[model samples]
Target: MPENPVDPPGLDLARLRAHLDRELPGTVQGPLDAELIEGGRSNLTYVLTDGTGRWVLRRPPLGHVLATAHDMGREHRVMTALGGTGVPVPGTLLLDPGTETLGAPWYLMDFVPGTAHRDAAPLAGLGAPRVHAIGERLVDTLAALHRIDPAAVGLADFGRPDGYLERQLRRWSTQLAASRSRELPGVDRLHGLLAARLPESPVPALVHGDYRLDNVLVDEHDAVAAVLDWEMSTLGDPLTDVGLLVMYTELAGVGGGIIPSAATAPGFPSAGELVARYAGLTGREAADLDWYVAFASFKLAVVAEGIHYRFRQGSTLGAGFERAGEIAPVLAEHGLTTLKER
Candidate 1:
C-alpha cells in the first residue's frame, strides 16, 4: 500500500465498510482503513486494510467521464478471465457493478508487494545487470500474455478482433474530440497518415492497451511479480502491444514530465533490441512497425490531453498533471514525424 492515503474525494470509508460487512460477513473483523493509491490519472485506486488483511480496489475517477475509457467491468472481466493463465494478475475477490456501494463500480484483489518502476530512481541501487534482467523479464511477460488463447480462457467474444486498429483509431479519435480543450496541432494529420498506412495485423491476442515498463511490478530478484492496470486490456493486434512498448522505451527520454517513464534505467534494452527480442520469441513478422509506433505516440498524446482536461476542471489529484497539457503537442509532433519517415 502507498503511504499517507486518506479517503480523498471519491471514496467514503463508512459506506465501504458497511458494504463489505453486508457482502461478506465476519470476513472483516476490525474497522476498515483506506488510502488512495498515487501516481495514476485515469481510475481511482485505493489500498484497503483491516489491520492485517490488505486488498486493492479500483474505481473510476470522480467526475467528467468518457464512454468506454473507464469501464470497471471490462477491467474486472479481463483480469478475471486471465486468472489461471500465465499472465500474473492478483486474485480477484469481489466485483460490484452498481454504484450504490461507493458511488461507482469497484473490485478487490490481493495486494502483491513489489516496486513498480515508474521512474529510473527505483533502479538506481540495483546496478546495471539487475536492471537488464528486469527489462528482459518485462518482454518475456508480454510475449507470454500474447500467447494466451482467448477461446481456451473463455474470452473469445471479449471484443471484435477484426478491424481492431480501425476501431481503435475511431475510438481514440472520439475520445479526443470529447476531451478537446485547446488547439492541438498535427494530431488529425498523424491520424490520417496512420489510417492510410494501416498494417496487416496477425492473429489477435490479449493486448494490454498500455503495456509499458512501469505498469508491471518487479520483485527484488528482477522478476515481474505481476502486471497491473487492466483497464485498457482487450483482444487486438499483438504488434500494437509491441509498438506501444517500443514507443515508450524510445520516448522515455523525452516525455518531458508529461508521462512517467522508467526506461532510462541502466542496462535496460534499447527499443530496437526489445522489438527484436519480442519478434524472436513470438516468431511474428514486425513489419509496418513504424505505423504502429506512430499510432502509439498518437494514442498517448490523447491520453495526456485527457488528463490535462481533468486537471483544468480540478478533477485530477496529482502533482504531475500540470505538465499533461504540454505533452499532447510534443507527442503529436513525434507521431506525425514517425509516420512520415516511413
Candidate 2:
C-alpha cells in the first residue's frame, strides 16, 4: 500500500472497508488502499489491501453495461462452484448482491499471486521449450474444463446448453446492435455466414466464455495458478472456448495491441497444435472448427465493439480502450475470411 493511495475509479475504499467490517468482520487490518487492475475491459477489477492482507474485488464496468453482461453474482457463483474441480479458480470470499455498498454488486476473492501474461515479451524470455510447455498447459487446462460435467459441478442450470451455437450468434448479434456506433464492413456478412454454418456442438460442458492465456494466471514454474475472469463462464458449447482460443492465438500478430497475445511468443504452440491438443485430451472432434473459429471472431468483434462503445461513452475506466474500436472491423474481416476458406 502506498503512503496515501488515491481511490481508483469505480471503487470507493472507505465504503468497501466499512462494508467488509460489517459483513466479514476482522478482515481489514489497516487503511484500505486500492488500485484498479488493468487488462480487464469488461468488468472493473480492483486489487485491495489493508496493508496486511490482499484481495481482489470485481464489479460491473462503470456504464453502458449490456444486458446479461458483467454479472458480479454470476462470476462469484461460478468460481465458487468450480472451487474443488480440476479447473483452478480463486477462492471466493463474499458477495454483495445489492448496490448500496459500491453502487454496484461486487464480490471479493483471495488474490492469487502470479502473472497474467498479456504480451509476448516475458514469454519470449522463457525460451521456446518453456513457452511451448506453457501453451500446451493452457490447452490442457481448457480441455480439463470442458471435461467437467456441469451437473456434477452445480452449474447445470448455469446456462441453456441446447442450441448453444445458434443462441451465441443471436446473443452476440444483440450485443453488437446495442453498441453499434459506426458501420463495420464485414460484420453482417460474417454473422450471416456463422449463422448459416452452425456446427453440431459437442456434449454441453462448463464453458469458460473467455479462456485464453491472459485470462489465466501462470506461476513461475510455468503452470496455471488460477483461471481468472469468470464473467462469461456458462454451460454451453465447449468448442466455443476452443474456437476463441484459436482466434486469439492466430490474431496475436495482427492484434495491434488490442488483443492479449502471449501466444505470439516464439515458443508458444501454434493455433493448430492447440486445437489438436484439445481434441486429443477431450476426445472431441475438431472437424467443424472452422465454423467455431469464425464464430469466435464474430463474438470478439462484438465484444470489441461493445468496449469501444463504452469507451466512446466515457464509461471505460482504464487505458487501451481507445484502440478497441479498431479491432472489431479487423476481426469481422478475419471471420469472413475464415468462413470463406472453410
Candidate 3:
C-alpha cells in the first residue's frame, strides 16, 4: 500500500459498512480496516480488511472523471466480463455505480496477493518460464477477448468502430497540449508522422489501453494472478494492444523493465519472437505495427509526464514522478527511432 492514499472526497463510510455487512456478513467482525492504496492516481484503490485481516475492495477516485476515460463502471464491467474466460482476474464481488453510496462509483473484488514489479528484481524472481508463459497468456487472452462479441456481453456501446486511431491521436494531442510542462520538439513531429501514416486497423476489439508487466500481479509460482488497471480499456484496434506490449518490451531493456520469455529471464522477447507469438495466436501479421508501437510510446510518455504535472500541482505524491518524466524523452526517442527503422 502506498503511503498517504488519496481518498476521494465524499466517501460514504457508513454505506460502505452497510454494503459490506450485507455482502460479506460475518466475515467483517469489526470496523473495516480501510486504507487508501497509492500509485493509482487515476482510480482510488483501498486495501480493506476484516477484524482478522483479509484484504479486499478496489474503487475509482472520488469526483467526476472523463466519461470515456475513467469510468469505474467500465473497469468493473471488463473484470466481470472476463470471469471464467481463462484470463485471471480478481473475482468481482460488487459494483456500486451510484454516487449515493460511496460519493463515487466503486467495486469490490477478491484481493489477489502477489508480487508486482517495475524495477527488475521482482521480474527476475518470476523467472524465465513464467515470464514466457505470461507472454503467451497475454496473446491468448487478447485473442480470447477479441473473439468475444461485445453486443453479446452488453458492451456494444463501449466504443465507436470508425476513426479510433484518428480519435486517439487527437485525444492525446489535446492532452499533451493541455498538460505539457515544457515543449519537446519531437512530440509534434512524431504526432504528425503518426497522423500521416495511419494504417487501416482491423475491426475494433476490447483493447486494454495500458497493458504492461507492472500492471499485472504474478503469484509465487510465476503465473499472472490478475491483470490490473483497465482504466484505459475500450473496444479498439487489437494491434494497439500488441503495440503497447511490444513498446514496453523495448523500453524495459533500457531501464528496470520485464521481458516476456520463459526461456530467459528479464530480457525482452526478440522482435521476431514477439510478433510470431502474437501472430500464432491471432493469425494476424504484425507488419507495419511500428506506427502503433511508436504511438504507444508517445502516449505513455504523455501519461508519465502527466504524473509529473500532477505531482507538481500537488495532486499526487512520491518522487516516482521525477523518474516518470524521464520516460517521456526515452519514449519519444524510441518512437522516433522505430519510425525511422520502419
User: What TM-score against the true fold does each predicted structure earn?
Assistant: 0.96, 0.98, 0.84
Q: Please report, in order, the local distance difference test score of every candidate based on alpha carbons.
A: 0.85, 0.89, 0.71
Clashing pairs in 2: none
Model 3: per-residue Cα lDDT at residue 271: 50
Off by over 4 Å in 1: 1-6
Give me the runs in candidate 3 sitting further than 4 Å from their true place: 1-15, 22-27, 38-41, 53-55, 60-67, 98-103, 253-264
lDDT of 2 at 257: 73
Clashes of each: 0, 0, 5
- Could you tell which candidate, 1 or 3, scores higher by lDDT? 1
**Tens-digit lDDT string for candidate 2 (162-214):** 88888888989999999999989999998888887777887888888998899
lDDT of 2: 0.89
Name the TM-score of candidate 2.
0.98
Candidate 3 per-residue lDDT over residues 1-342, each given as its tens digit: 334333334355567878778876875676655766654546667777654656656555333333455577888888888777667778887887777777667788888887555555555566666666666655666666667777777778888868999999998888876667886758788888999999998877777888766677767665677888888888888888888888876666453222222223454355557768878877777768999899998898777666656656665543344456666777788898999998
Error of 1 at 144 (Å): 0.5
Provide the lowest-lDDT 10-residue window in model 2.
253-262
Mark the regions of model 2 whose C-alpha exceeds 4 Å error after superposition: 2-4
